[model samples]
Target chain A: MNEERELAINPIVQTSVQHNTQVVSNIRNLTASLFGVAAGTLGLESYPGFIFYLIGTFIVSGLVFVFRAEGKPSEYFHRPLGDLWGGDVFSGLSSFVLTWTLFYGLVRA
Target chain B: MFSSPDRRLQIADSQIRRFTDSQIISMRHKNEANIIPSVYSTHEHTTTTPNSPLPLDITLELLASILLLSTGIVLTSQPLKPIQWSRWSGKMSREGRHGTGRWTREGEEVLSEGDPYAFLGLDGGGEGRRGFFDVRGKRREYAEWVKGEPGSK
Candidate 1:
């Protein structure tokens, strides 16, 4: 009761609580991208042969950073952290299309 | 304690106006408090709530696709299909822009990258659908639960 009374009278404690929640939200977002990279690496060796496989590794790492940007606050995800896994879905889908078109055009021709 | 009649009347009117103004301010404050509670409650629901977007089976399909793309394997025999990425890209681009300035060979590769859903965990190929990648049961379940609310219909 005393603590509540003090907090009600003190603006500083209320501000601190708000800031702490925002900080925790930020941490949750940062941790999510680490998961993104691990998920990205699941089928990496499925590419053609040697060179594409290395390319795959690089792609996954890059994805870790690229997708991390999406984990921040936005109207869509609407949290302190952006949606890293969601961004991975997007990047992966695009990567798939581009690879299929170029590979098909080159090999088939 | 006798003031002039006109003075007394003026004081009474002034006090009445002050009381009305405070009442209006209090009403506004109450409305604001109500809105704050509702917003907080909704936020609590989304982040803390544990609902899955796609059905468990479908989510497994989605995660398989993500896993494949993550592994850097593309199913070459298949034709390219554009999913909901264009919409996602629009939102992502607004934050830190991707693939700007000069496009390197590596950048080109990244741009023309394979399906991320394959890696994240979605199946993208079928007679009526497509497989993104492949996964077993436990890994599939873990991936689906971890990924965001899938926007696929």
Candidate 2:
């Protein structure tokens, strides 16, 4: 059998390749959204609310992306919506609390 | 003895992750003093397990919740109230305006008055609106309400 062919046929190699492909797909999604968020947040014409929105999106999306890349709920082959929601809820509550507590202090000071 | 060099190398690389994962699990379980090897290996790892962690049903539920949340936030953030106009035979309004041309309609039903809250799925106390977090509450409530149902916990 051909060397390259034999290697390519390995199930482990296939799994690795699948993993790599998933990573690349996730990276592309993140990069594209990151740019959009940055533009919205820092744009001269955009609302100041955009800045808070961007920060919130970043924290939530970052957590979700990491968990997804880590193969959370891997048995289903597709990442679960509950994972994303849990991530979003947790992040939202965190950002809401942090922004109010910390940002308010900074503004007041 | 006839395995090609590239084939052998490929096999080695393929075994690398699985071997590493197995070793890490073993090391973790054992909690041995010598943990230097797994430290370096687990650092660069992303997702390397012998099997996926979540079961099929729970996984699906989780996925459903995520989709719901993303869509919900986007839809709910927009101001979508419908325009309404009202008039009376003769009435003077503020700002030098007259003829009872008020926006409020006390008895008139607004067309296309779909509740945006409901649309975003925040309008109900039911499971459909609660997502995966509802599973536990719903189960416990039903178990108690079912009246002598077994496994009521």
TM per prediction: 0.16, 0.18
Chain A TM per prediction: 0.29, 0.29
Question: Candidate 2: where is the Cα deviation over 4 Å?
Answer: A1-60, A71-79, A85-91, A98-101, A107-109, B1-153
| Model 1 TM-score relative to the real fold | 0.16
lDDT of 1 by residue, A1-109 (tens): 9966753553222232344334333432332332233223222223442333334434443443334333233312322233322333333434444443443333222
Q: Give candidate 1's total backbone clashes.
A: 51
**Candidate 1: which docking quality band?**
incorrect
Tens-place lDDT per residue, model 2, A1-109, is 6956743553122333344344333433433332232222122133544454455455444443444333343322223454333323333433334333442233222
- B130: Cα error in model 1, Å: 61
* Candidate 2 to truth, TM: 0.18
Candidate 1 segments exceeding 4 Å error: A1-82, A91-95, B1-153
Task: List lDDT for all candidates, in order.
Answer: 0.35, 0.34
Q: How many pairs of residues collide in each model?
A: 51, 7
Give me the displacement of residue A106 in model 1, in angstroms: 1.3
Which number leads on TM-score?
2
Instruction: Judge candidate 2 against the unseen true structure and give its global Cα lDDT, from 0 to 1.
Output: 0.34
